[model samples]
Target: MTPRRVTVVGAGVIGLSVAHELARAGDRVTVVADRTAADSVSAVAAAVWFPYRAGASPSMPRWLARSLIRFAELAEDPGTGVDLREGTVVERAPGADRSWTAAVPAAREALPAELPPGALSGVRATVPVITGSQYLPWLAARCAALGVGFSPRTVPAVDELAGSADLVVVAAGLRSGELLDDDSLFPVRGQVVRVANPGITDWLTDDEHPEGLTYVVARRADVVCGGVAEVGSWELAVDPAVEASILARTAALVPALAGQPVLSRAVGLRPGRESIRLEHVPGDAVPVIACYGHGGAGVTLSWGCAEAVADLAGAGLAGAG
Candidate 1:
């Protein structure tokens, strides 16, 4: 029997991951995208394992847990651009959601010294931190090794692939809802500044920072300092004022980075929706697996979402067979 032909839309971490999982499952996978991982919002992400700005989903726990496990496994190989690092999630309020802790068994309440100034509480855990510049290309190479093909082109519609593809997986980030005509989708704008790493290895996130959402993530090459989550904003240009504020905030969080040379600045519009859509589209001429709307947790949730998409594709293929 000929292997099933699967066309995946988008080449970000999520799309590449879905392609890898499906191809590994013996499908003929082809990834179609206008932006590869390096140009996609995934590249702009601090790429930590924390679930930031992801809306509620019934499968969130499972997805987070599975992704954490996969990233931990990937970290064993440095070439994969994944690292297991310790971090603190600074809490400003007493009743902040601790639901994510269920997925991270090693998570524990931080000591007073671990907490930043004025922090009400904090959680410390060692989690995966992905360096996208390295991880994206590595993922694409791994997918190619698994016999997955890539097409550098725009996919205007999912219907266009119905004739040649046995199944279509839509992972098109911000453009997914437009392709599928789902108006519930929106863009959550995020901005970050990359600075020279001053030998910092640990990461810190202050979601409840009085000024804005602040985080400091140390990668192998550079330290990522950010950010601001602007809802319903689509502007991609870097804002000078925002950048200054980010620099100041991050400096206060990690003093060593105060005088560090600026490396780069980036702005990305994260695909936001009420919840992630990862299911079969009903009544379509072709079998379509909808797997987009990851928001800021795209990297945090990629592998788990990919596995779920693969499972859906497998079930769909078996039914068709």
Candidate 2:
């Protein structure tokens, strides 16, 4: 059998995550991207293990469970350079969203009243949240160490991947509009204000359990931050009004964040689709797999999705090709 060298498009979290998995499997990997992976939307995502909020999907909870288990494995390996930590996710108004808590029974726990006014119900556990800026650079470096190449050139179409790589994996995130030719794909704009603080401890999540879902997360670097999910928004430019709204919602959930010196503000798009695109297409005889439309869940779902992609690619290479 001839050795298969794989070309992965889009170095975002999902693409890189797939590359990492494949590299571990001893496949030759090359990552092609126009912009640096760290600058992509995957970097902008405030990674959380929280999967779809129940009613959000039928199989999401199951997929999340599988991904989370994988996340812990990858995060525990310092070689992967993941920023995994323990966090307490609270569902407002307590008794609400029990079904979601039940989905991940490992999360539910008792919280003291002093924590928040509407602290209805909660769950506490350690999970991995990849700092995109840190993790992507680490992944790229590791892939390079394994003899994988990084091409700064942009692939405009699946055919363009021919001869560039033996096998093609399209992980372009949202930019797949050109290659995949689906302009219906758009960005779900979000703003996150990271604040450096020594006081804000504990990884927290504001899942709309009871009252409403609004929350903040603490970075390994001690930046307690908050974010927003504004859909169909193309504006990468952070609006003053949206920034204020994000800060206001954050403060409302965690008072300690109020009056604290803000460190910085960032905006990134969460590529969305009615359904996630993860399918194999033929690219001029080179195998092509498209893995996009992660929406806001890419951070949480990347691990599992990568595994799924690798498994599919392995089948494709095993004959019947």
Candidate 3:
């Protein structure tokens, strides 16, 4: 197959994934973004693999399963910054979203001992927990090794790349809507506090916490304590009250995180939409593939969505030919 020139916008997990896949498929790929992967919001993600706030779609299950398989495979190599860790999802209400468990064979009902206080039920499963600090850089390096070139710049619109590349992928995360003129995209604000690990390895999530969504994800370097999802919030300032509340809630859930010296705190705006947009855009000057609006599942759904994007890009190129 002749290599088609492809430009992917954004350097977050989704964009880098698409660039990697396309380059691997013999496409001359270039990633154009305003920021590097380490500087993007994906770097700030707690990055535990579950379909948290994922779009409701029939394809969600396939994406989840494919991503799970890929992450498990990557976990075999330490350089990938992927870890398959056992964890518990605390359910405080009846009939919470257990849809993710279907993709996980080892997922099962947690024993009473596993349940945190004030939890109605829980699911114990081994899922991929990504250390973004390592993973993002690793992914970008992998893309580079595959001959995927990167252009660091602010792209005002996808049309700007029409003359330069044969195909364009819009994976600009929060800024995707502005580029595509699709107002459906919005920011779901998330804040997390990183702390020194206290010899804890297992992870825990309590989305049903009455105060806010709480989770403790222990990676190789630090334990990520997070967070709250605020819809339509664009504030980047770290809130002291929110940090205190997060520490209190996470410590109450795990207890081990108590008094752990703070490493750092970060706030990120997850690109949220009614459903993820991962399809071809018809009637454009350049054949455009839309693959943004992954919300918090950008890391969770990265590999799977990238494969889908590559397939769509292939089809588009074939048709163009």
How accurate locally, in lDDT, is each candidate? Answer: 0.93, 0.71, 0.91
Residue-level lDDT tens digits of model 1 in 191-263: 9999999899999999989999999999999999999999999899999999999999999989999989999
Of the candidates shown, which would achieve the greatest TM-score relative to the real structure?
A: 1
Per-residue accuracy of model 2 over 138-229 as CA lDDT, tens digit each = 77787788777788887867886687577788889878767866775777777777776656546677755242335577766645465666
RMSD of 1: 0.8
Kindly report which residue stretches of model 3 are placed more than 4 angstroms away from their true locations once superposed. 319-321
> Model 1 Cα displacement at 127 (Å)?
0.3
Candidate 1 lDDT (Cα, 0 to 1): 0.93
| Residue-level lDDT for 215 in candidate 3 | 94
RMSD to native, candidate 3? 1.0
RMSD of each: 0.8, 3.2, 1.0
What TM-score do all the candidates reach, one by one?
0.99, 0.86, 0.98
